[model samples]
Target: MRLPLLLAAVGTAAIASIAPLSANPEVELAAEDMLAPYYAKLERELDLPVAPAGAGLAEDTVLTRIGVGSCNHQSRSQHMWAKIAAADPQLFLFIGDNNYGDNGWEGDAALGSLRAAYAKQAETPELATFRKAVPMMAAWDDHDYGFNDAGASFTPRRWSETLFETFWGSTEEVRSRPGIYDSRIVGEEGRRTQIILLDTRFFRSDLEAMPYSETRPPLGPYVPSTDPDKTMLGEQQWKWLEAELAKPANFRIVASSIQVLTDAHDYEAWENLPLERAKLYRLLAGREESGLVLLSGDRHAGGIYTDTPDETGGEQLWELTSSSLNLAFNNTASNTAREPDPKRLTDFISEENFGLVDIDWAGRTFTMTLRGNQGEERVSRTVSW
Candidate 1:
């Protein structure tokens, strides 16, 4: 069921700072009363937006467009979502790290933080408007999952997993599944398009820490080992993905919070799990899927990366990654496309913008545009693949 448009609720922690009880008891009490009911209701109705199986497009497919992005600091620019809504996308994919909730803790404090963090975003006027208009789905990153650069072994992992499912509005059936990863279909013109939403953070291995002596950036330009065991998509999800992809579909959109293709982002990405990245690339290359596109968010910028087939009969896949709908860090370095790095597999790159993906099945073409808050088109491209 669709929820009513909600006013931005203050994060419990932020509320303490914004409206300390000692300073304003009356206002604080009123806010608490209003927020308590909604919070309680959501906890109970965690499994609300479950679309039935076999539920998808039939003949006469509709033009579907999706807007994707990540690393949004909801507290910074929560009211600026209109720029995204103006594009009129039917779906919004929140890749991960949606809320900067610390993952180091669990229990009442951690869950409360996650709820408050999401509450801050949920109450934003920009997101609220879009939610009222379009459907939204999300996955988790380190922050929302409990720790910065954490993995499946984290203590809060299971609880964080349940919270992610509930907050994103999954169905009871889906919640019963072993993992949060699932697929949905939207069909048109006798062609069915499957959107595969994968859960990367749910079962990731811990990212190695950097050496303190290194004077370089805290994140990296470091190379990851190509060990066959080092993985981004864990074993279960990886196996599930193959089966899901093998199913007949006209198109597939894989959503991940981390960068799928290696890039110059000094942040975390699939590159950190090099072997897994190669495995995914090889899988897509060998797969016979008609139209395969990758959707990712997390870099705080939007970019389109396509692979042209080589002499081998292997197929090529295209990736479109957008980040930070409201908050973007200005890349001091040139933001233009750079030559593909030989060391790392990153093909193209752009930083500091959000993305709008328009799919016109009837026209047999897809268009994606990356825009800044001022509505400037930072990057725009279309592909017939």
Candidate 2:
């Protein structure tokens, strides 16, 4: 088998340096036994012809609208799908933590279970209704990557990648390529929008465990240093991202699973990968023509951030992060007072909320609304370019 560039790097000295815990042999076997039948079903499903897209939705359509969220489990949050589908957006971007794959990887079997979980969620009436209207795209986080807060050091990283590919239904061309950062262009003339999705977790370095301290809350907050060589998108993906951003688009949206602006929620984020975060921001700042905006999910809440240049002279871009189709066990706090930038670093923050973004192709103005479960608008802001 020809190893892709990403697999080649991962199989070599890089991953070898960080020895990972071996999975339990029995769990692997059990997961495989459960997976066999699902794979067969998926093969049949993929064989079905995809529906044709709307005519007006051509590559050069004037405006493009997108819906985004993260940290969803199938058994919970079944109600949110209908409301989300009603929005009738152009695309749905899942920002990761899509599944809770705590079970050890037992080859295709483990993958089968993961795929089955996603299927149940996707088949929900609300999501199914929306799928008929729009296509979906996604990137993986730690949960879906087979471990919580893992990196290149994860034992099943390769297996996890394959499962992600199977679930997302990307073309073989995409699957065969290395690294998951992807770009999409929409609209025509002055209304063009470019969306760049970053793959943050697949090849990440292990986050240093926070040290315990008395003065500080239990664990002292850890922040990433701007090490020139440290990275978030990995080498190839970073190169691809830079080239993608350099293109001429009316607006550019960068989607990340973790907060890029806020320093709070110190477990994992761009803050933990400081050099990579700065490199990304500098890229946006340098691209004067591309009207850049950021999108994120993970915190299980929704909020927005506007880059406010400080007196110390730093550029700040905007970030809009919405999270959780339903709250997870540990992250449920995110649904209650879990602001992405609690320390007041971000311009706006909210908990127990979702978001909707609207774009007016002719007017060149967009509205972003933070909403409650009942679909009542809590916070609304407009962005015009």
Candidate 3:
């Protein structure tokens, strides 16, 4: 069987030195033992430190418009920022993969090349201009978290957390925590909007991939885990999430870096952690009137889906999946698997796109739009909750 690149990243002698811990991940290593050579490599390579971005969004102000997008390749054209800026979004969520710097290695100085990718993104003038006009919040997925499809066992994660917090301007409360899971309740009472950012990587258990020798799964590369002992959010984050949900808010936006509702595919998602997905459903079970919505990125394609009252056992939950701000997977070369989601209400948008959420407080309704940089609205759905 061909080993995945993540496993190959540790093929060098530097990583071999930590094989007692790396080879047997469950033993776990201290942050000090795994951090030095790893972070030192990135520091030596960065053109300059990645400065913090977009702070001081007022909680008393009303937020009527919101935007979200992910899966950005730092090297690609960032023209989408102009379109996002034009929309006058009160808040923009940078959900993940904001910096693509994975060079398939993590244990030693291999991260220098990855640091350069982040430096390139920070220097993008379009993003700089957008940050000036828009107050942004961010959460990282696999790539920007330092490697593609990585989790807790990834040696450099502690250092990766520091880099993420520095670039995105994470809150002091977030910095004090281990994982980036946090909640922000902005806007005044009645018009309050709660943003729940999940850190699916920092404390997550490693994923179990489907063998390459076996037929590739129809959608992506991974197998579902039935082991309930395995966790996606870890104990502390789960406790944090339950408490965050308890705080009352007019509308709640749960931002996950990976898809949550679609189950047909074997790709990295809440589906892989079945019990955890159920727990989320149970948490939102009675929030039918909360104007709850789910936002996710990571899939190269974009689409809209729903978890009806019957499906989730509470309210009508809609999930808007927008991705690949520049990296479109429409071409067959990207992948051959067809995403088969029976619950999807809109056609899969396989082109470059972003998601827009417009709220009409008077009507108690919200609209989710999937559009391209040219203002092409490929799919849209408005829900009255």
Candidate 4:
């Protein structure tokens, strides 16, 4: 199987250098003899400072600027943090692929890799300063969740959840759940904004791979799974989402680790489970009273998509996706898996990028922008509610 370039780069070096406590005699003996002190040092360095309490933004505070991005390789330079900080967002949302742990090995090796990745991220001066300056929330995609394109079947999911909670300091209510899906209401009363972080990886069923055909052009290896029984969020999360939508919030931002609006992309996305996508649309349609916007990551390239009013109950539903804070698919020629989305408002940007959402309460308008590492705006769309 072809590995992601980042995974390939880390490859054996990670195994040799960061193997955790293992039962395999060779690994175990090596850990005890040579890696123990290294692990100890990493543990000390990984100690992230505690963020001030509360649900990030104050309920009474006006919601304005927000920063979002994903697919950051832990070992790589996170030069975007400075630009992201410069954007002056009140909150930062890390949608997924937060770290390229790619811990497929069994037992303690997975734990060790996760620790090492988190340690690298925590040690980054820019990242540490950003964390101190901005209140942040996160959701994990495949890499940080312990495997590539992993889902409910990933055996180490619970262990991954444990690590994620500890490193991110997730709330007790979120930690109590089998999955990391959580929702928080920020802002207050008439200006309240609900941020629903979806756990797409935990309950998602296995995706269907496309069949090879001699007559058809190979779009990619995946096709929509027509299985009505399959789900992206499990039944419990679905119920919780319904309840969240019913809450009286002026606007709601649903954070998915993968693109929800771009169905033509033949990658890991909501398109793989058409029924679930339909369900999400239906949910939004049913709750037109609550203004809804989608946020996502995972795709290295970033763009903004808007569904027609007909599809969203006379209101255009917008999805802003930002990805690869430190990594980008510069070779666009080789990445032709995505079909052009009619709803796309901006050119897809394949560079080290992040997204900014600026809400104007006085004008009752919002502008979303995809910006490069240096804070240069690549594309932006301003729309009124």
| Candidate 2 wrongly placed segments (more than 4 Å) | 1-57, 103-116, 212-222, 226-228, 309-315, 328-352, 361-363
Provide the RMSD of all predictions against the true structure, rounded to 1 decimal. Answer: 10.9, 7.6, 4.6, 8.1
Model 4 RMSD to the real structure?
8.1
lDDT tens digits, residue span 1-385, model 3 = 2222433565322443221134244434543354465566655765444643654688796878899999888888989989888877898998998878675444353455456776787788888888888888899998888767887777667677777777676779999988787789988868898889998988777777877766656667877887787788888998888888888899889999999888868779998888778877887774434788899999888888987534465466799999879988684224323655677877778788889998889999899998886867878999997
Most accurate candidate by TM-score: 3
Residue 158 accuracy (lDDT) in model 4: 60
lDDT of 1 at 301: 57
| Clash number for each model | 7, 3, 0, 1
lDDT of candidate 2 at residue 74, scale 0 to 100:
58
Report the candidate with higher TM-score, 1 versus 3. Answer: 3
Which residue pairs in model 1 clash with each other? 8-123, 57-187, 61-188, 61-189, 103-146, 103-147, 301-352
Better of 2 and 3 by TM-score: 3
Please give the CA lDDT of all the candidate structures.
0.61, 0.62, 0.77, 0.76
Candidate 2 lands at a TM-score of 0.76
- Compute the lDDT for candidate 3: 0.77
Least lDDT summed over 10 consecutive residues: which range in candidate 1?
A: 14-23
Measured against the true structure, the TM-scores of the candidates, in listed sequence, are 0.75, 0.76, 0.88, 0.82
Local error of candidate 4 at 149, Å? 0.4
Order by TM-score, highest first: 3, 4, 2, 1
Pick out the ten consecutive residues of candidate 4 with the lowest summed lDDT.
16-25
